[model samples]
Target: MPSTLEQLTSNRVKLTVEIPFDELKPSLDKAYKDIAAQVNVPGFRKGKVPAPVIDQRFGRGAVLQEAINDALPSAYSSAVNANEIVPLGQPEIEVTKLEDNHKDVLVEFTAEVDVRPDFELPDLAAIEAEVPVIGVPDEDVDERIETLRQRFATNTEVDRPAQDGDVVVIDLEGSRDGEPLEDATAQAITYKLGSGGMLKGLDEAVTGLSAGDSKTFSSELLGGAHAGETADIKVTVTKVSEQELPEVDDEFAQLVSEFDTVDEMRADIRKALESMARLDQAADARDKVLEAVIGKIDIELPQALVDSELEARRNQVSSQLAQAGLTVEQYLKESEEEAEDEDAFWTEIEKRSLDALKAQVVLDKMADEEKIGVEQSDLSELIVRKAQQDGTTPEQEAQHMMEHNHLAEWMEEIRRGKALAQMVAKATVKDAAGEVLQLDRIQPDGSITDAPAADEQAEAVEADASTDDVVEAPETVEAPAAVEEEAPAEESAEKKPAARKPAAKKAATKKPAAKKATTKKPAAKKPVADK
Candidate 1:
């Protein structure tokens, strides 16, 4: 096998490869056997048809095409590896030459594809980023405490009209054009007057309505058969009640937490908020440092890759908005984004998508340069973090990871994260007060501490092993099958990029052979399982 690379562009390349007759013999043999099994012959048994006989039935050209298609992926992958190319998208493969004559049998092809361009990393030690000092406001603490108080609050029936903060039990009858809508009717529904998540104008309609008092209002149906249509809603109040929160004292502290005093609880809350602020600051610092690094590098991006990423992001956003039952206009109105119109919103999305791609490329290059490797411990930590984020058990998260064949994807993510952490550690970070920030000591649990010794780390993992079920993942996880870089000439020109193709695992990781977990999935909860 011989391959030659040509620099088509700074971010694109052309690879011309040649496969000898001997290298293609295996594919040719398999193609003949496959075709013979699919076709019936007059005398020869199925799968035993001679090569010349099959050629008489199906042209030698067809056999060669099948053989070439079968052999393309391995050959192209070999060429890519030989040239040390990091492909960014699917290659445009073309069979430039195919000689099947008895005298000279050879196959030659060319692949043109977008690739990652080489760029120098900035001097990370010289880069500096500043974040605001961690300060938990008194109001924030009070608000957190108020939430706990509300959780323990009790309700008592009141002989009075419904008002804000009052929980009212009511019966609803919805009608459109004087016809009753069965789908829109409910009885003995308890609603908080000022909650604001229910029907529009419901709080005003229920307010001042005493028990047994009835009022009618018009609101759009949100779901069911008549979704988006306005209907007349008749509300008959059956009961009104008000919440009585527990006093903010030692007794309340004892009831809500293990703490014995309100002061101790408040102090804990303050500490928790401070820890949360530190985490937020760390995240902000990471972003700022990454942005600074990106700003320092000058790299050309492939337009097609950018377009593909933007399209994917748009589809994802559309899906999320649809799930939330929100249109773009409604979402923008409710969101804190500065984009005021659809055009501006999509423009922002494109910019963010491009930035994300650049960041990916940067981190990938850094990982290569630094030789960052994903260890079993790294994967275990990732699974544990995922479980915490998804509110599921670590075993469940690991099962999901294996079931979905995300081992390689997660490993890459861990490598990139490690690379970023190294860069952030090398960079100078400071707080608003001009005090230097030491983020390298920040632990995965969000606490700032010294790195634990190897034995201590092992012991910690052992302690959590019962709950985490730390998988013994291989150092290298194979990626999902990619699109064949070699294709039939006709099909090669229009093949969708590998990123856009429907994924089918050629060698998916096997699910654990242990008993399946019997814990039922929580309602309205799902793991963020996609890579």
Candidate 2:
């Protein structure tokens, strides 16, 4: 085989491959077998149509086209392998030569496809990630302990108007222009003020209204069939009450925790908070290192990649929001885009997707260079962790996930996680004191450590992708709230549609499904092959 390469803009390449007629014989034979199996010609059995007779009836051009169609994928993959090409999506193939009558001649074709542009990896040692050495603030310790105290607190009825933090009993009715809405009314509903967990304008409606006082206000329904619909709401305050929190003492500490002393509980809270802070710090360090490494390298991304990524993300986000009981339209409106248009949302998705792609590509290259690999234990640990979170055993969860066609996705995610773990370990991480911090490696000692406790909040992308708060990692390992966790599921979540700590988080890259032509006698059609 002989081939020539042409560089096309947009990170695409054109490969013109030439093959001697003898080399095309295999595909020719296979195409004949396939056609014979499909079409019936007169007195012959289903698969007994001789090549010569078939050529005479269907024309050699048809046979040539069929053969080319059958040959394209293997040929392209081989050529790509031989040339060390890294394709991003798929390829578009065009057959330029048939040589139907001249069996001794050559067959030639050209494939124009998007490929990953090659870029050099920066030294991992040179990358620096600064993590603040966060200590448990004393006030936070008190706050955590106070939460426990509140749990054991008793509620007492009050005769005064409601205030923030006060629990109120109320009767609520909602109607749109005087038509009562079903499922939009509650009786004796106990709501805590300042929680903002109810409809818009709810806290204001009953705040100063004492028992038996009724007020009507216009507010938008938060959920149910009438969500996003404005409804006139009427409320009657039945009771106002406050939580009589247990006194912070030794007895209260014994009731809430294993420790018997309040002082001990406070100390325990500090340790727990400190551990959480370190995990948060770890997550931050991973993001910083990935970003720093990406910033050091410049990669020319394919437009096809961005388009595919964007389309996938659009679908993924839609899928996720639907699961959480929200519609795309409703989400977009609530997002309040700066441009006040859908374009702004999509533009931000594109940018984040591209950045994630670049980061993962760089990390993958480094993984290969450093010979970092994922181990079975590493995979098992991750599976077990995910299983525990989902309330199932690891084996059962892994088996179910595999049965549902997620094994490959799971494996790829594990590999990328290990790769990222390697990068984090090798990365130069420093604390607020400028002291170096070494994060546990991904199975460096054959025991995988716990990943950072990811924040479970789902950021409304259409509303918040452009916000400075949408961090770098994904939500879960895979979810629409982040990037498409497949398609290289750019760890660019949050790309995390993972935890957005490492767009590498959502590393379950999906291969876009290729389109298959449905020509009955494809041999007679044009020899062009597509992805």
Backbone collision tally, model 1: 0
Best model per TM-score: 1
Q: List the RMSD of every prediction in angstroms.
A: 15.1, 9.6
Among these predicted structures, which one has the highest lDDT?
Answer: 1
* C-alpha local distance difference test of each model: 0.69, 0.62
Per-residue C-alpha lDDT of model 2 across residues 93-121, encoded as one tens digit per residue: 66787554544646788877777677787
**Candidate 2 segments whose C-alpha is farther than 4 A from its true place:** 19-23, 38-64, 101-106, 155-171, 180-189, 193-214, 218-231, 236-243, 310-350, 371-410, 441-525, 528-531
What's the TM for model 2? 0.70
lDDT tens digits, residue span 77-192, model 1: 88888998888767877887766664446888888888888789999999999989988789877877766766666778899888898877888888999999876788777777
What TM-score goes with each of the models? 0.76, 0.70
Steric overlap count per candidate: 0, 35
